[model samples]
Target: MRVSVVIAAYNAQGYIAEAIESVLGQTVPPDEVIVIDDGSTDGTRSVLERFAGRIVALTQGNSGQAVAVNQGLALARGELIGFCDADDLWTARKQELQLARLERDGELDAVFGKVQQFVSPDVPEQQRARLTPAVEIMPGELKQCMLIRRDALMRIGAFDETLPATFFIAWLGRAKQGGLKTAHVDDIVVRRRLHPGNGGRLHTEAQNLQTLMALRKAIKAQRPPE
Candidate 1:
């Protein structure tokens, strides 16, 4: 498998179909698409079952997204790892373009593209350009928009299972400290849903603070004062 797409799903029945369809529609279909069901009480299981054989479904106790992601990472057999939130949708060409870019630049450890946010599902075609502006990315930008090398993930330690909500922040800081080569792609590859029901956005203030603090600790551990 060249690429593994991991998604942590919890009560995502409302949006799981779109997420799955987005992956299925990718220009470069992933070698394996794994959906970790973190004990969703909703109809998420049934929805996932509909895609059996099409996707690898792993279910476990309610361990939260971080743990689920780690499990998926461990199970992934791809050289590259792509992450997608169960609520987000990817552009059809996202994986294909990113894989080609990565192959062309073999030195890079990872790459992140642009992301757009929408409150309502009916975003206008022309107005969609209001999303994130094209900008050069530093490793500190954000992990959600990036595709990480599987080996890099193991070296940095997949999502920190200890801190459920702030794992990505810590992981990104560690990657930067370890001198991973990274780049940014200007094209919009995914759409971030902004509904209040979404856990990440709804708890952004708290999670952001926690993530920042965790990142600081990780950075200090990686680079002690000279």
Candidate 2:
């Protein structure tokens, strides 16, 4: 099955090229790579222009990651939808491995893999394990490490534009509500770069609090009646 990989970028001049190159280097490349340039005043545009026909570029006012992802989702044409951050790199066999698993088991709607958080220039490899929640609806989960079916994504109504960093919790809730089976690969398929300029890294406490609040609300809303 064909796949569409969407990357939401903002002022990613320093790392956008590597992000794109990683996808291009995939064993089974994506049918298309869509980059949503959310009004980056830096050299983002110039860099994207250099890629030219290699990528499908979409630009808009500086809305946020949610909006950028939604824009890409709306335009995506693949059965399988994948996400990648502008500052991260993917495993060379990411697409091939993920797609093979999906093809083998056609019933899974969402699949995630291991990821390491890169805190500095020398990013060390960290082994991440996947945890399945007992209740199947937990907070503090859902992240930038998976390939999801576009059909399931659309059913969940795309990414929530309301909450920013914590929207993953909401998406997971939606997946639960939709009865989508969650699966994961054991390899470290994605690398999360952490630096001072990174949004969540700079405002860790604030974003964490916001995400916690969002998670609480989702759990309460989904909690069974006592």
Best by lDDT: 1
Candidate 2: misplaced stretches above 4 Å?
120-143, 223-226
Sequence-dependent TM-score of model 2: 0.86
**Whole-model alpha-carbon lDDT for candidate 2:** 0.78
Clash pairs, model 1 backbone: none
Cα TM-score per model = 0.87, 0.86
How high a TM-score does candidate 1 get? 0.87
lDDT of 2 by residue, 1-226 (tens): 7789999999999889989999888989999999999999999988888889988998999988889988988888999998888988887887887788888898988788877665546433351111111232121123457788888877877777877776766777767876887787777787766655667655779788877877776778788899
Q: Candidate 1 at 114: error in angstroms? A: 0.3
Question: Model 1, range 72-114, lDDT digits (tens) per residue?
Answer: 9889999999988898888888887778788898898888888
Q: How close to the true structure is residue 79 of candidate 1, measured as C-alpha lDDT?
A: 95
